[model samples]
Target: MNNFIKNLLLSNFNKLLQSTKIACPKENLHNSNRLKFYNPGKVTYDGKLNCGITSYLTSFMLSYHNIDHKVWLSKYGFGDYLEDHVHITTNSGLLIDTTYRQFFIDYRSDGNCDYYKYLFETCEPIFVGSPNEFDLLKKSIERQNIKVFGSLNQDIKELSDFWKQDINITPKMNLYDMRKSNEIHPTLLVEIPSLIQPLIT
Candidate 1:
């Protein structure tokens, strides 16, 4: 991709990350702990956040911006068990994961999670192209004698349907109607326009 588009995507992504509140529920502490394999940092646990939320928020932002992207879920095998992580792939085949930083933060501070550390430090936005290409990259990593986590499995679920459903339920028309009827608080209504403008327009 050209630098201009790359910068635009990066800027919008950072803004979305700052604006959106992506968090898991502290009430589901047990479930949250189970997903910690994908979240390797103190901020994630303390903030009650997980990789799923990050993927959702990223998808939402991309949708709002009218960016052509698909959410990819990959299941990884851990001996007899499996775990999943979701991330986005652009129409042009670029991979983007705003949450990979969590792993880096943990690895930098604790000097553990070497695989995740290497991944975040090396890959730009993570893997590019299809899952097969991703598999090749993983194999390359393993060939280096690196103990890569999660052998990729066949179960992959695309999240475009979920995004469509969410958009349908939370239509911008309702927000506009609420604002027009004075049903929404003035301050919130004011804030809503800036955020929803892209989706509506």
Candidate 2:
């Protein structure tokens, strides 16, 4: 993409991100202690659940903006499992989904999650492409008729119809390491715009 377009996308993304509402429950002592992983015989002290709120929000924003993103979903690392970050190439300005992180609350039905709301609030401008997961979340959030701010993808109606009968959805993932690889070579700044055509108007 050209410099002008890239700058415009960045500007819009920042504006949207600032307006999104991504809130999390405070980490309390009890919840903190429950974060340890356990095995049948030897329960190792694994650690806290990573916070993917930021990473997921970034990806969601990129997707909403119609920008091309490459996400990296990695295995659990130090600290919380959800604590992931977004990476944008300095030159090409492409987005990547380095990881897929989601959270579930037992008290709520499928998709009605704080995690999704947090992401929606954080990743501004880009409307959520009603992935089945997102529809389920929307249903869950409607108890109070809360207004959703951004746009919904054109496919939302179909996804809602297809997923309406399927209430039992589970969140699972294969964690990959998201750390930047050794600097084998310098980051490239290609002018190729095909990969990101979806994001640009």
lDDT (tens digit, per residue) of candidate 1 on 122-183: 54432234445655554554432234434322221112221111222223213334423424
Off by over 4 Å in 2: 2-9, 12-21, 25-51, 75-201
Note the Cα lDDT for every prediction shown.
0.41, 0.30
Per-residue lDDT tens digits of candidate 2, residues 60-89?
Answer: 444444445444433323666322232222
Off by over 4 Å in 1: 1-5, 12-14, 19-49, 78-80, 101-201
Residue pairs whose backbone atoms clash in candidate 1? none
Best by TM-score: 1
lDDT for 201 in candidate 2 is 36
